[model samples]
Target: MISSRSFVAISFAVVPFVFFACAKGSSLPGGGGGAGGEGGDEWSGPAQSSSSSGGMGGSGGMGASSSSASSGASSSSGGSGGGGSGPLPIVLLRIGDGVTTLSSAAAPVSLEWRLTDGSATPGAPGTTSMPQVISGSNYQLTLSGTASSEGHLSLSANGKYVFLAGYAADVGTLNVSTQIVSRVVGRVDASGNVNTSTLLTGAFNGSNVRGATSSDGTSIWVSGNSTTTGGIHYTTLGSSSPTQILSNPLNTRCVHASGGQLYATSGAGTFVNVFTVGAGLPTSTGQTATSLPGLPTLGASPYGFVVLDLSAAIAGPDTLYVADDRSPANGGGIQKWTFDGASWSLAATWNDGTAGVRGLAATPWGGGVRIVATTAENNENRVLTLFDDGSAFPEIVIATIAPLNTVFRGVAFAPQ
Candidate 1:
């Protein structure tokens, strides 16, 4: 469980760019709209709702332990249903996040998710997608729907889940900028089941949320880029909507929580920012984020990322992996950097193929790391797995999994 913090709510610089990289070539798997994927202050932000009757109202205190059911996106979006009796597989894919069209009808669909593996449980295609297994919490959330495209995902600090910031597709269009944009936070488990999820809706007045991350498994911080009221939205499991905790940095895209430290990609400057996590996401709205030092000026295209620690006794993370959706020529591809307590250095760059890689996840391998990634948006997009070792590559391609109309978005892989 996460403890609450006080926020003062500072004015975050509005992201002038509504990153809808639907440009000519590389873009988000061809669907809804998302471009590049920012925060501030003491505990001052949006006030919580006062509803008491929970089912799906706004105050969040109620949780319904219902069986996982089939949503409209079941046929097209990814899903979670396997009974994790034995060792669970790695990789979680966020299929349709509602905004994208799956059926020929171009109808809005619910959020969908799928759990498979890079090689162990091998799927024709993959996502959250990776081969290496990580250990985190003990619960999960199962999803089903047709999300044209959705945001990226992250595993909890302990590793058992893929934290997700999703819209409730059963109701309205989650175009955070122009609509009420109902969002939900999830803990996708090993059996591909989200045991307890957080619902952020009812009175949310934010915009363009794209990524989610958690320190423990109870609370989540969602990041996005909006021209107006968009920044860091927070909520606990089973809650309704969320409170905007900080608003300083602009165009906050993807977020990750590692080793008690909170890190995120900033669209405003195409760089990464770090926040000191005190139990949950920083509560003081006045809290300021520091730019991650030692990067080679990532000029946009920086999507989802992962930070891994080689040793717990070491105090901080030593290895970092960042996903840039631009072509190698334009600084696109997967970047592997190593950190020495004080600074980071270019360890290597992987951009052999797959146009440009977007969202990525990694696990410790032999002497290196095993990585899984989703290619930059393309009609023939793919889920790929390559190894630092303990894996393979021609880059094993996990493709034929989803229905033809579905586009795979965010992915998470955590093993316990």
Candidate 2:
């Protein structure tokens, strides 16, 4: 059986560091190579081929017919598809005190929202207090402290609500070990206010809810650990209980829902657990875990992932972007995979010795896709990196916002 690892915490310190870049291309301080071989200081080289699995589409009641054909076709054409029109909104996870352990001294986490003008600069910080307001962005308001141990964030399909996953316990003197421990779910209106009362406690299995995503606004799927085992659970917004969808002892780390499918990664190895979500829930009772192609036999630990269903934009197939936190010595980097309505194939990989790649998000920019990633270095310094869709190497080091002595967790782009 795979063992679960505890979350690390960063020391307490407050430093505000923000840098904006407008250049179309800029290299890292040390110029790294591509994704495969060793380089001076940049990423290694492009991706290499790995093992493959038989098509799992038609097994376990998991088939592609349930996905919207029109949406898939539109995405395959590329560019902005269906509802991806307006300016892109950026949502970031800011964890205070950096600790994942339950404690009274733990500071509350916050979700920062800002709109981009297709440039690298983030919208200026709002002057108001708790509910910080971004003057000109679709997310007119920013919020924090609505949930404790909030490790992941996802917006509802309608863009009206934000779903959060993690554990929730009382703050300060009320904190205790016997407090509810589970993969909890919380919801907040997109109108910009952080209302703690809106958070739903004990909504699922009492485990550390590490990842969450919603296909439609009505239902949410969460992945997390419960003592000796980890599982994927589901619950509707405003509900008090979540039903266990799939249970495994693999130490699930993150999850993403797209194109009628749910993708989850495990910290135990390079396997990506895929599920067919039909009618807003898992169609079967188990997962179709597929090992990532092209990854070396050792040092491949998959973390957070994102699914880009360009089938609606380019009329092609859906793409999966996975962040592998393995050290540079073992080929640590980002891995790209393409699904042809069945199994997945290795597409590309990129990394620059900077391990701890956690969260991932992609948005339409300059008529193509722009990918943004978060890297937490030994839980000390957190860096946000950006890469162009088809670039040979990572394009820019957008900003380093973790100077506040906090570790960054999950990130998501506001629904377009």
Candidate 3:
């Protein structure tokens, strides 16, 4: 339900923070990291492994196949992963307001993470049983408002961090706006451990929470809702204050701060855009921004995306994977675009029936890439894994989450 003028909103369960629900069959649409060791223990689940031993192949265009293949495939993940016996990959996910981890692999899909706390509400809860300041901060947002909570991989001045961006809303009626009670950001280690007390004091119902840093991980550019900018902002380590950065064509959908560059999804006009930052990503605000060349001007609702560069040079990435939530006719699905010496081209589209995708993550495999994504805006949303070798293959279901009344949002690679 998008209009030329404004992005529509829908209240979810007791949490009235407007849920960013993209149309299942409709379309256009629209983040990163922080300190390390700030997260404490609070995880429980089976880890998925993505080894490149054997997989299936098919012929032709982007049409997908669900038929099973032999063991040894791939899963969704992060970092410049190539050869085998590498770092055990970690997949970061935003299930509700809280975040969790999945050990990624190439074979049988990982099992769905379910609530063992025994709350009557299994999926999205009306009143959260999670802590309140939350109480202990060691718990997951299991029985709570289910919405698009964006998670990103970032770095502190010292180490890598996973940024969990989300907010808690006061009890209210569905479809009716309510007061936003808490805007919070959780920091974690690569293993999904809570690192610090979450905090965010603005009106932003953060769609993407990320930060840009040089190899040093300081003087950064951050993303999310701000009281002043309403889009991307700038912040640093050891402090909670954020300065307004980008103002025009404001985007709160999702953002990525990497390699002295800022990439974000700016809605229907352009699928993805970028902003330039000073080297070292200096602590100051004030920077120049612009829409990227060759991206579609309309008909794409992109959520999570990965801009990857495997070349030896530090130039702009050559591979781009955008999570578009529109139907196949309207350009919905996981759109794979490749950059030549110049312009970008649509390489492929992966889908699950008519349903579209929202959150996403990827890493290099045996000369190919392993991708994991969440289905969106339908009664049958899911968290899935795919092994892409430029061929047609069956999509592996990690979990059919709609039955839990829950929806998955932003996803990222944990610090490797």
Number of the predicted model whose lDDT against the real structure is largest: 1
Clashes of each: 54, 36, 30
| Candidate number achieving the greatest TM-score relative to the actual structure | 1
Instruction: Give each prediction's root-mean-square deviation over alpha carbons.
Output: 17.5, 14.8, 13.5
| Superior candidate under lDDT, 2 versus 3 | 2
Name the lDDT value of residue 36 in candidate 3. 11
Instruction: Give each model's whole-structure lDDT.
Output: 0.44, 0.41, 0.40
Models ranked on TM-score: 1, 2, 3
TM-score of 2: 0.62
lDDT of 2 by residue, 1-416 (tens): 10112112122222335332221010000001112111111111110001111111110110000011100000010111112133345556655433443233223445555432222224423211122222221111121222222355655544555555534442331322123433345455544444322223443233344556666556777765544334566667655466665665334556656545565665443343333333334734565454434333344555556555555644433666666555533444456666766567656554433353556665444444545455534233443443334533322232345543454556566433
Off by over 4 Å in 3: 1-88, 92-131, 135-159, 168-182, 196-198, 203-222, 225-228, 268-283, 311-315, 378-380, 392-403
CA deviation > 4 Å runs, candidate 1: 1-88, 96-149, 171-177, 195-197, 202-206, 270-281, 311-315, 389-403
Find the 10 residues in a row with the least total lDDT in model 2: 23-32
Question: Tens-digit lDDT track for model 3 on 1-416?
Answer: 11111111222121112122211000000121111100010101110112231222221112231212111122211221123223223332433322222211000111122211111112322121223223554322221232332333333323354444433332221211122333344454433345333344453432223222222333444454333444556654434565656654444455555444565564523424332333424445565455556677665566667666644543667777777766544556666777775777777666643356766666555555656566665223455455555654333333224333333444444343
